[model samples]
Each structure stands twice: as structure tokens, then as C-alpha cells.
Target: MTRLTETARGVYVIAATPFTDSGEIDFDSCDRMVDFYLDAGATGLTVLGIMGEAPKLTTDESSTIVARILKRVNGRVPVVVGASAPGFAQMQDLTRRVMDAGAAGVMVAPPGSLRTDDQIVTYYTQVAEFLGDTPFVVQDFPLTTGVQMAVPALARIFNSLPTAVCLKHEDWPGLAKITALRKDGTLNRRISILCGNGGVFLPEEMERGADGAMTGFAYPEMMVSVVEHHAKGDMERARDLFDAYLPLARMEQQPGAGLAIRKYIMFRRGIIASPAQRKPGANLDALSRAEIDTLMARLDRRLKELA
Candidate 1:
């Protein structure tokens, strides 16, 4: 398998775990989803992310899904799995399993318990030690993790850990952080910076030196186009594509309902067999669904105009 590296760029889509209405893992849908992502031009696929409902899956289910996706991908692109767990042992075990099963690398998010910069740096340093040469992504998502990582602290984590190869930057209002990281002397090495706010800020993030987006905003083709246009130095074209999907992207970014909205969009687009979530997770109601359908219709019409 070609492993993910600090130079990895373009979109590494945070994939949704497909489930049947009966709440069973939908393996068929998983295959279709993989094909859809690659067809839409994803550079890689990231499974079992926080939005992918990683916490709800059993250990066996996680492995099975990753293996299935890996087999389908057949090394067309890198596949990064989330290995974030409360204990280092669980994280290490998952990392080993996924990497051995052909995953490119794993992503680790700091525990909310971390309180100080030293603690944050120490946590990732230990993570690198536990990972033992396996490349990993630093998921710096303070909005969800509740662990704030200052730029310097992040630099320390990246500089001190040779195995840490990417930063899944999800800090709100974090454009400056991207600039700081890209600045000379911020770190002794370069790493991929993939922003993850559902690609709503992707145009700006790309301008601020983000390699691309590592997000699940349903319409991944939009993110792919934005990144490609920006890379070609076409700011107006990038923003135009981004603006076409901004409403749905913004709605899909809502704190609690984002995943539901994304699943609904994916299902309506026929990327998944069902829009079901596991127990304790709700699908969108009729009104919510109607609102999203309206936004999607508007997006389709706008995309045609842009084309």
C-alpha cells in the first residue's frame, strides 16, 4: 500500500459508515460509497472518523469495514483510518490492524482531558512512540474535542514527532494558525494541513496554505473542484464553485445535525443504500429533509449555470 505522507494533498474524504434501516452494517453500500468517492476525485478515504460514528461500532465491525473498503479501493488511493481511542493500547492495536490491512495511516485526536500545552505535546509524543514509525494525522479539532492546541504547541508536536505526518486542522477561525504553521521556522519539517469544517471555508483555507480538505460535506466533488481550482491559482473559480454549495455545506456543518444531513444528502444522491443511523442517532425529519432538498435543487441549478 502507498502510505500517506507529509506531502499528501487534495481531498481525503471523511467517509460515512453506511448502515441499513435495520441498523446493520451495509456492506454493499460501503462498496458503492468507495466507488463514488473515488469517482468524485478524492485523493484518499478516511473511515471511522468522529462524524463517521466510530464510537458506536464494535471492534470487529471496524476491522471488517476497513478491510472491505481496502479491498474495493485496491490501492487506487491512500486510505486513512481513525485510530483515536481513550487508551494507547487500543489506539496502537487499531493502528496496527488497519495499517496491516492496507490503510495508509491513522489519525489521532487529543483527549479532552489535556489541559496544558506541555500535556498536549506530551500526549502526541507518546502517540508517536506508541505508533512506532507508523505515519499518523494530528486531528486538531478543538470545536469537538474541547482541547485547544495553540500554534506553538502544535509545532512542537509536529517537530518532535517524525511519524506525525498530517494535521486535520478544524479549529474555528483558524486561518491565522494555518499561516503561522506555513511560516518559516514554525517547524523544522513540512506536513500536510487539511482543514475540516465541512469544506465551507475550504476556499479560504486553501488560500491560507492548507493542502486541501479532509471533510465529509456530502458533495465531495465540490471540495475536489475547489481544491483543484485553487491549486491552479483561480481564486474566482474556486469561490464560485464553493458558493454554489455553500448553503448545504453550512447547513451540514450544524453542530448536532451535520451527520444526519450529510447522510440524507448522500442517500438522495444514491451514494448509499439507506440514510439510517445506529441507535440513539436520528435521521432527518420531513421538514428538515424538505429544506435540504430545496437547497440541493438550488445547488444543482447553480452548478449548471457555473458550468
Candidate 2:
């Protein structure tokens, strides 16, 4: 297994869980999605994240999907599973299962109840202890978790936890925080910093010292291109590509409707079989779907013009 480490970089496309119209797991679509991501230049894959509808799956279903994707990936790239849960036992169990099944690592998020620096650091300390020797990613998504962790607090987690190897940085208005973390001596040792939020701010995050994106935007190729161009010192091309996708990227960042829009686009692009979310989730109305159609058409024209 290619375990995720501090050196990990590039787009780790957060894989979405595909479901049939009747709400059954669409394993065939899952396989095709995996192929699409790899061909799109994703360096790694993260499954069972918030966008993956993880909380909706049974324990058996989650394991099966991870195993299936890992099998499909066949060690082509590192695969990180989102193992965040309400309790350590659940988290530990999932971590062990996926790691043993050849997952590169797992990601854990701070629960919303955590409200202090010590609480945040202490929580991750216990996580590192429970999943002894298993590499993990610290998902600092304050927008979703509601736990505001300053750079110092996150540095404390990384400095203290040898197993914490990467940060899924999703703090809104968080570019300065990235600059802070990249400063000398701010962290005891370096760890990978991959931004989230659908890659809307990816170009800026790269400028602020992020390695790459760990997001679930429908266009993984755009993130891949931006990172590749930036790494090659071609900022003009990077920004041009980023600008072309900005409208759709902004549209996909909507609060409740983002996932629906993403799935619908993937379905339209023939990457998935169904665009339906599971029950108790959001779906796009006809007007919203039409709007997305218009945006995608414009994006295609923009890309060709750039070419």
C-alpha cells in the first residue's frame, strides 16, 4: 500500500458514493468513477467523506465500497478514507478495516462540540493513540465542523502526533492560516496541506502554500491542471484555467445544493448512472438543473477558447 505521508500532493479527488434510483449502492458506477478520476490525473482518492454520503451507509456497505474502490485503484495511487465518527470505537474500527484492506490512510475531523484549543489538540491526541501507527489526515473544515482551530492549535496536533501526516485544510478565509503554517518553526515538522471547498480558492491556496486540493468538484481535471501548471511556474496558464472553471466552481459551492449539482453534472457527463441523493438529502429542481446546464455549456466554450 502507498501510505499517505507528509509528501503527499496533487489532487486527491474526494470520491462520491453512487446510488441507484432506488437507493441501492451503484457498484458499477463506483468503478467507472474511479477510472475517470485516475484518468483525469488525480494523484489520490478520498472516499466516504461528507460529499460521499458516508453517514447514510451501513457499516457493511461502507467497507464494501472502500474495498471495491481500492481493488479498482489497484495501488495506482494512495486512497484515504474518511473515518470521522461520533466515537473512537467506531472510528478505530473503520480505520482498522480500511487500512487492512489497503487504504493509504484515513481522515478525521474535529467534532462540532469541541470549543477550545486544548480540546481540539486533546481530541486528536487521543485519535492518534487509538489508531496507533495508522497514518491519518486532520480535516480542519471549520465551516462544517464549527470548531475554529488556530494555526497554533493545528500545529500542536501535528507536532505532537507523529501519525498525523496531512491536513485537509477547509477553513473559509483561511489563506493566511496556510501562510502561517508554512512559516519557519510554526510546526515542529512539515505535513501536507491540501485545501478543500470545491477548489474554488485553489489557485490562491496554492499561492498561500497548499500542496493541492482534496475536494469533490465535478471537474477533477481542472484542479489537476492548475496544480501542474503552478508547479511548472506557469501562473498565467494556471489562473486562466482556474478562471474558466470559476463560475461552475462557485455554483458547486452552494450550501445544501452543491452535491446535487455535482452529481447531476457527473451524470450528464456520463461518469455516473444516477444523480439522485439518498433520502433525507437535497436534489436539484428543474430550474436549477437548467441553470447548471447553461453553466456547463459556457465552461466548455471557455475551455476551447483557451485552447
Candidate 3:
């Protein structure tokens, strides 16, 4: 197994699930999307994430998609499958299937009902027990999960769970959390901290001790470039690149409508054959599409200037 580890850094593009106009999984587009990510310099790929429409997929479909992705990825880079579930049985089953399918690891988000610090810690304790030796990433996206993990709770988790190797840190205003986690003696051991607010606060987060990004922005090359420049100690270049894509990134980060916008851009870029969303998913109207086009145009010009 290509286990994910604390040293994992750089862009791990949260992949989108491609579907045909007829609403079937578009396997061909899945392959193309993987290729596009690799060409964009993605160090890793995360599948079945929230942006990937994991909840929308059936159990059989989820397993099939993971198998197809692992086959297509062919061990080129680590693939982390989102295995969060309402029950331990489902989570464990999914994790076992994906790991058996050759995934590098899994990402588990806290259940939305968890609130108190003890509840959060207990929930992860159960998760750690279920996952056993499988390395997992703790997804700390409070905006969507409704389960805010305080600094002390998070520290307790990291200190206790040996298998918790990385954090998909998406808590808004999470810069201080990163600083807290990186401070001396805060955690029993170090784990990678990657921000995921569509790379909106990536510059500050990086400066605040984040390892990198694990978000699903349409243009992952932008995230890759930002992290690369930051790693090279060129803050100006990093911010310039980030600023060039900020408009589109903001537009793509919309809550309910964001996935449709992202799929449309991916379709326009020829990474996917269609921007079709499954039932219970939103589709972009003419006005939204026009706005995205305008943003893309501005991004193009700005990127050229930066270049």
C-alpha cells in the first residue's frame, strides 16, 4: 500500500465525479480528469470527497468508481478516498474496499451531529479503532460539517491517534489553528496540515504553518504554483499567482452552486465530456455561466501578466 504520511504536502486535487448527459458515470472522462490533474502537477488526488459528490453515489457506484480511479491512477500518485459515513460499519466497509482496491489512504470528516469537545474526541476514537492501521486524514471543515473541533480537541486527537497522519484543515479563519498545532509540545507528533477553503486564504495559511492545500479548485495548477512559490520562499510570486486566480476561485467556491460551476469549467477545459450533475444536484443557468466566463477571461489576462 502507498500509505499517506505526515510528509505529504503540495496540491492533492479533490477530484470531481464526471457523469454523462444521460446521468451515468463517465468512465472515459474520469480517465481524462486524472490525466489533466497529473499534467497540472498534482502531487496527489483525492476522490469521493464532498466536492466529488460522494453522498450522491450509491455504495456499488462508490466502490466501482474507486476501483476505476485506482486502476487509472496506476500507483502514479497517492489517492485518498473519502470514507466518512454515518455508521462505523459503513465507514469500515468502505475503507476496507478502497484500501483493497489500492488506495493510499482515506479521509474521514466528523459527523455533523458531533458538537462538544468530548463528543468529537470520542467519535475520532471510534474512527481510529475502526480504521486500525489505515492512515487517515482528519477533515476539519466546520462550515459544512457543523462539527467544530476546538484546538484542544484536535490536539487530543492528534496526540492519541497514531494513524491520523494528515489534516484537511478547512475551518474558516483556521490560520491560528495551524499556528497552535505547530507550536512546541502541542501535539505528541507532527502531522501535515493542508488548508481547503478553495485556496482563498492559502497565502496566509502557508505563512501560518500550513503544509499545503487539499481543496478542489477548478484550476489546480494555481494551487500547485502557489505552494511551489511559497516553498521556494518567493512570497511575492506566490501571492501574485494566487491573486491572478482569486476571482475565479471565489466564484467557484459558492456553497450550493459551486460544484456545477466547477464541472462547467472542467467541461469547457475539455477535461470532462459533460457538466451533467446527478439528481438533486444543481445546474448552472445562463447568467451563472456568463459570470464564470467573465471570471475566466479576467483570470487569463491576469495570469498572462504574472507570467
Candidate 4:
């Protein structure tokens, strides 16, 4: 399999699931979206993520989407599938299906019920057993998962599980965690640390030793450029580019309405044909749409100035 490892860096775009106006999975748009991400300089692709609207899809739909994406990617870059489920049996089954379909790896977030450090470690230990050699990413975004994994607990997970290869670190204001993990002797093994708070904290996270970003922002080129500039030690250039996109990024990250905003942008950009989400998802109103249009226009102007 195409396994992810410590050396993996640069933007691994969290993909959005495309749907028709009638709520059917838009397979055609899926192909277009994959191509768009690669052309925008994504080093890898992560699908079925929180923002990918994974839970909104049925098991058959999930498998079909992953299969479609893997075929489109065709090994150009690694594809990581989110395999987090309430039960290990479901998680394992999903992992096997995706891996068999040629996914590079899987990502798992702690269930919302996990509270203490021990509980987090125990959960991952079970995850490692269930996965059985499939490389996985530890998604530590307490704001959404409601499970706070402290540094020591994470250290133990990294030390114990050989297959845990990366982190989608999205702990809000969690720059300190990145600093702590990168400190010498903190983790038994080195793993790629990718920040994922909508790339809002990417600049600080990189400064604190994060490899890059693995988040969903409408304009992934912004993330790609920021990570590249940071790697070249051009902090000023990185910050300039990040700042140019920050307004739109922040707007696209609204808790209940973020995905709608993102899909609207993608549709406006022609990456996807429609801005539709499955049932139970909100669609942007005229006011929200107008605001996004304004931000995007400003983003264009700022990018031109930077150039």
C-alpha cells in the first residue's frame, strides 16, 4: 500500500463531497474536484473527513466515493480516508474496503465520549489492533471531538503504535501541543504533524514545527503557497499570502454553515458543478452569499498586491 510517513509534508487537502441539487452523489464533480486539488499543488488528498460530510453518506455511498477518488488520484498522491466509527467492527470493515480500493492511509478521531488521557490511549490502542498494519492519522481536534488528548497520552500512543504515522492536529489554540511533541524525546517515533483548524493557525503551527496543513479551505492554493514559503524560510511572504486569504478562510469556517460556504466557493470557482450538500445541511442565504462574494473579491485584490 502507499503508506503515509513522517517525511510527508505540504498541503494534504481535505476533500469535500460533491452532490447534485437533488442530493445524489455527483460522481462527475468528484473527478473534477480531485483534478482541481492536484493542479492547485496539493501533495496529497484526504477524503471522507468531517468536512467531507462522511456521516451524511451511507455505507454504499462512502465506498463508491472512495473508490471513485482513488481511481481519479491513481497514485499521483497519497489518499487518506477517514475511518472513524463508533464500533471497531464498522471501522475495520470500512478501513479494509478503502485500503483494498487503494487508499494510502486512514484517519481516526477520538469518539466524543473519550475524556481522560487513559481513555484516549486505550481507544487508539484498540484502533491500532483493529487496523492491523494500516497506517492511520491521529486526529486531535478537541473542539469537535470533545476528547482532549494530552501530550503524555499522545506520546504513549506514538510510542506504542507503529502504524500511527501522522496527526491531523486541530486542537484550538493548540500550538503548544505541536511545540511539545516536536521537543526532543517527546515521541518515541517521528510522525508527520499536519495542522487542521481550517488552516487558520497554519503559520503559527509551522513555526512550532508542524509539517504542514491537512485542512479544508476553499482556496487550497493559499495553504500550498504558505507551506512552501514557510519551508523556504520566507516568513514574511508566507504571512502575506496567509493574510490575503484569512478573511475568506474565516468565513468558510463557520461551525454550522462552513461547508455550505466552501461548496459555494468551489462551485463559483468551477471546481464543482453545484454547491449542494445532502439533506440536513444548510444552504447560504443571499446575505451570506453576498458577503462571500465581497470577501472573495477582496481576496483577489490582496493576492494581486502580493504578486
| Estimated TM-score for each candidate | 0.99, 0.99, 0.98, 0.99
lDDT by residue for model 3 (1-307), tens: 6899999999999999999998899999999999999999998999999999899899999999999988988998999999999999999999999999999899999999997999999999999999989999999999999999989999999899989999999998788889999999999888999889888999999999988899899999999998999999999999988888888899888889999999999998899999999888998999989989988888888878777
lDDT (Cα, 0-100) at 29 in candidate 1: 95
What C-alpha lDDT does candidate 3 achieve relative to the native structure?
A: 0.92
Question: Which pairs in model 4 have colliding backbones?
Answer: none
Instruction: Name the regions of candidate 4 deviating beyond 4 angstroms.
Output: none
| Number of the top lDDT candidate | 2
Candidate 4 — worst ten consecutive residues by lDDT sum? Answer: 1-10
Order of all candidates by lDDT, from best down to worst?
2, 1, 4, 3
* TM-score of model number 3: 0.98
Evaluated at residue 236, the lDDT of candidate 3 is 97
Superposed by TM-score, candidate 1 places the C-alpha of residue 67 at a distance from the truth, in angstroms, of 0.3
Clashes of 1: 0
Off by over 4 Å in 3: none
How many pairs collide in each candidate, listed in order? 0, 0, 0, 0
Question: TM-score rank, highest first?
Answer: 2, 1, 4, 3
lDDT for 110 in candidate 1 is 94
User: RMSD for each model, in Å, please?
Assistant: 0.7, 0.6, 0.9, 0.8
